[model samples]
Target: MARDRRPPGRRGLPGLGKLFDMVDFMYLSGWQKFFERRLQRYGSTVFTTPLFTKTVVATDHKAISALFDTIPFIQDYGFGSAVPPKPLVGDVAPSVFETGVLHDNPKAFYFSLLRHRATSLPAVFEEVLREYEVRWASRGRFAWRDEIETFTMDFVLRWILELKFDTAKVRLIYNNIFTNHLWRVARFFPWTRYSRSLRYYGEFVRAIEEASSFEAIMEIARTFGISDRAYVAKQIAFLTGMNSYLGLQNLFKSIVGELSSRADIRSDLDLQLRDAAPGALFSPRVRAVDEFVMEVLRQHPPVFFIFGRAIEDVVLESASGSFDIAKGERLMGVIPFAHDDPEAFPDPASFQPERFQDDEARAKLIWPRGIQERPADTADRTCPGKDVALLLAHAFCTALVTRYQWTVVKPITWDKHRYSLNVAAPMGELEVAGFTIRDERAGRPV
Candidate 1:
């Protein structure tokens, strides 16, 4: 492949180029909409742009998998060079995908660690969720999105770091840290809340030290050679932020807000839950909840796009042909478009949970990124928590679908517009008017 032979992409003003997105396209539709429209016109699997940096966006699965398969990925997801690679990421284990400290075989190290922990996740998650319900059980209605966000922060902090802070305090701190997104806060100095994010993270570390003998990062430190406890904690905390505002909340809103709106779908969910063993509400035998979670991930995954840069020169192939992306050029996977592609999904944007029931459709749907049999290498930039994420989603929705009747007070859109850039919260504050808890023991709606 020759250099500069790339797929067609939208052109923007010279020097400025698609950087105009911050000002021009933001108000018109959204960041995701701009790419969706362009991909529709271009009809290419991969394309290059001058957005933020020289960007090549791909919507094809093979192209995305090829990008992750390449080793030593440096410029990934966030803007490289413009922002610090990591600030205050202290001493500890490196991430499997984006290495905190690069190594030749860190991928296997993380894969082993993550895989080992998967089994215990089910029991651990159920305990944390029970705590969540006990803490925030209320009458009348409340914004389920905000409630879930608070619950998620607590769940992650307690389960992973064993950092037990007041849930209200955690929400207050996290909200302010991302109050203005990174661009507004991180770019400016004294005005920046970036340091505050670090401070709160450090607080979690302190709390963990005070709270217990077991720290999640300590597992990595003891396993790996690094004694940099602070760094390992920071890295784990950062990645788990996927649940903080990005992955989990987006999923909750889509299911409770959108999917539940269809009376038939809600009935199916109730029937399936009723048939399951009451003792194990979301056991593997209760497969509808599993299918429902997969559909939610397929439609409104936490990330709208996946970004990475070439460590060195690399070739990316598509059904049409092959193109070479030079070292340092950025690449993005436009997940939303690919998830909703009409040909790929029979009724693409229709919120059909039944589509996921077929293994063939599930195989083609690429939003969850990579969670098939071959196993995830730390080298893979795919979401490290993919399996646990699915499990947690199932557990959460099982609780809600089985025990409560939720109604969406306000309409929600899958196009993520509300949360700060750090989070890919797919919907805004989902005002759920009536969330009445019903007795599941009776096997009938209250």
Candidate 2:
């Protein structure tokens, strides 16, 4: 075979580097560091390597921003392959041919519903916060990640379902599907495919399908003229639940942790919320709080990478050079690297919320779908619920600061330079002992 002409990268284990990429994509904790280090070492922002398939990892901020909207680079959900291939539970894959749709209608309906319901989120969040507040205040210190995870799960379920369901049972279902050890282990050992957690995932999917019978969901199905109401419901639930649940947990944890450590930022935040009336408490007229949320997302994006497939042979032109990618090839835009690119973000390493106070600088902050200024759309596969996510985060920050003042039980430190790609480590770094909270208004222990 003629030597494969491609931009060079770490050719992991063997067999076109499939095994290496699999481990790096899944089991490897800080897998993104490998991409970053390789990009830095090879002196190229765009380099080809074997990831789920032959992949071109693009780290240049401008290149990535343009590629997200480019026609050739389309969204790929990794169907009929390893690594969470079956995102839904059904014989009919949720694609154009199978579902007679391409997620546009369903996503549009869901996004509209979520946006319409956005006004109600403040009340919902306050209710959920109160429930946690009682428990957290009584104990004084709780496992930060565990508590926040539960809090987010409750909020997501209630907001999406809007039905009276057992919160604890629903939490169990989500936990088993997402974080259960045995279910994860079963993936490696084929014989253990019958794991109970795996069964629960199936059951959870079915439950979402059954939930279509609810009046709230029926209204969505009726409005969209969707014949397969069950399928639409399942897709909406999966999109809204998993992505928002996981993303919000990280966002919430990071916001709380940041405020705890940075006294100056916290003090500034306190002054901003000082004069808010009850009606304005949830949606405070505050710039610092909103700016702080944007900075957190830029510095520590909840989803590190946005992946897609190349639908046609195309050349990605970056300042580095034009890199060729073949049809059917996989690609990932490293958001962490793009957000930290010096050309885009000055003093990228420092935490500065003020950077976003400017409209031009704020527009540069890109999440998975598109730039901050642009609304998400189905064509680009940008999450439609992007605004809703920001709304909830902003409201949650207001509720948290106004409700209580918190102190870390043990010092929590995050070294982004060393472990930016380690998604699972930050939450654990938040220790349970010695953390305390006090009523901000009353100035007494909660």
lDDT of 2 by residue, 204-267 (tens): 6566666643556667666766667667656655554456776677788878777777888876
- Name the lDDT of candidate 2: 0.66
- Candidate 1 regions exceeding 4 Å error are 2-5, 10-15, 40-45, 68-120, 134-137, 172-198, 215-220, 242-245, 308-315, 319-328, 367-374, 416-426, 444-446
Task: Report residue 82 deviation for candidate 1 (angstroms).
Answer: 6.6
Per-residue CA lDDT of model 1 for 1-446, tens digit only, reads 36647678755677678557644445565666666676677777677667665678777666765544566335344323333324433333335334444532343444555665656666667787776665444645566677777777767665555566766644544455323346345645744556555556567656655556345546655666645656555555544453344566566666666455667876787777777765364476467777777777776666556667777777777643687877777777776667766656777768777887788777765545553323444545555566666667777777777776667766655554432443344356676665556788775445
TM-score of each: 0.81, 0.84
lDDT of 2 at 17: 89
The most accurate candidate by TM-score is: 2
C-alpha lDDT of all candidate models, in order: 0.60, 0.66
- Listed per candidate, the RMSD to the true structure in angstroms reads 4.1, 4.4
Model 1 compared with the native: what TM-score?
0.81
Q: CA lDDT of 359 in candidate 2?
A: 91
